[model samples]
Target: MRDNQITKEFFDWIRQGNSGCIFAKLFVLRGGDTPWEASVIRAETFDAPTVEAIGETLKLASKRSEAIQLILPNIKTPEQIARMISCLCKNPNWYCTEIIPKPSEYTSSFLAGLRWKLPDAVNVNWVLGFADIETMPPTRRAPYTSLAIRLGQPGTAPSVAKDKPNEVRSRKKENGLVPVHLADMPTPFLKDDAIKKTWVLTEQTAGKMLNPTPEFRTNAHAKVTFALPMDLRDSLIGCFTPVAMDSKSEIGAEEY
Candidate 1:
């Protein structure tokens, strides 16, 4: 049939490594038949003159074949974009094989938040869903304490809880980072004073901290956060005394 032949040819075109697209913030680039690099610049906005200035960056990146982003807008029209994309397969300096049309919301938001601070290049492997992204690099100062408290007897446990209305994944351990802001150095709360000890108080003064003394808060870099591991959860058998507290989050309550 005519349709069958046309479909075969279209699939063949893609199968030959002639073209492809990814749904991330970047498009994959190939030199010869091997994918060696990637870029944020898309062919749909083919502003050739604007990219002329950064042509060398593209060439160098392609040669190094590093996965990084470029600042180049594309042109209009699918036909025009096709021509621009096809150009990637040709010239050695301009060997840009595939052009990804759009970026996912997660990838776009992640890149947008960091591009201002790290405009040059961001490691593709650093995004979410990838391997562990170390909040504090191993090269940094060693943690003074890593309290891993558990409640119930531990054995085999599922990574996520599914019995409830929603499934919740287990949390990884987080290091408490110390804060060293200049304004916090003078407010010490660990002095000999009965006047300040009459009432039960949580450290919400001079900014706010849940745990860690005010003196220790300024000296050590730490944030007040509390999270319980799902695997350690156990139902109480005795009478339960309920305790509740009011709190506000900087962002707000998350829906999903």
Candidate 2:
């Protein structure tokens, strides 16, 4: 199927309120310098309200992270800065293929708080990126944290790419889902040539991307879940405006 057609189908699926369908939001950052850099700062499943709230947060965070990158000589790579922000944000869903740095005293507190806040059922797969074997964690533990390495050779690093939010938004509009992009919003962060964008995938689309073949069905009994860490939740809640609902009205209520 064509890319546009697939996007249309995804939008329709989201609109239909299909069971097991979730909206996966990805925050992508890219740079224009010679040694190119691109990284996904945050990726999480969002309910409608959380999506808008996160868009605003991403604008602020992107600017802040970039500024910190300029000041901190130790933070050279996008992945390094991303990891630092992940710790500060206490975002458990932060994905990185590189070796995550050992948390500093300040960041360690954030990491511990996040680990403590994790629900008993949620599992974290920790990938060690260090070249030295001695730095690796010795064992996996509960809340199901597993120590491992990212499989396969690392792919070529992502370079600065053109903004495609409009294309995605138009495709989504054709099938009835509202598409939100960081680029369209008014913010000081977008002044630079860096790439800022967000795209959502329905659970069905996410499944196809993860496991494209009919023969490779994921176990029906298996459960996979992700939770936002405490710090991020607190930060977003502070910024989010809650909509008031009438006690008597049962219709038009948002359910997560």
Off by over 4 Å in 1: 1-54, 59-66, 94-256
Tens digits of per-residue lDDT for model 2, 163-206: 33233222212012121121122222323243222112233443
Give the per-residue lDDT of model 1 (tens digit) for 36-105: 2323333354345534644554445534432323312233222332344333323322221111113321
**Lowest lDDT block of 10, candidate 1:** 108-117
Candidate 1: lDDT of 253? 8
Worst 10 residues of 2 by lDDT: 135-144
Quote model 1's TM-score: 0.18
Provide the overall lDDT of each model, using Cα atoms, as 2-decimal numbers. Answer: 0.21, 0.23
**Model 2: colliding residue pairs:** 99-129
For candidate 2, what's the RMSD? 19.4
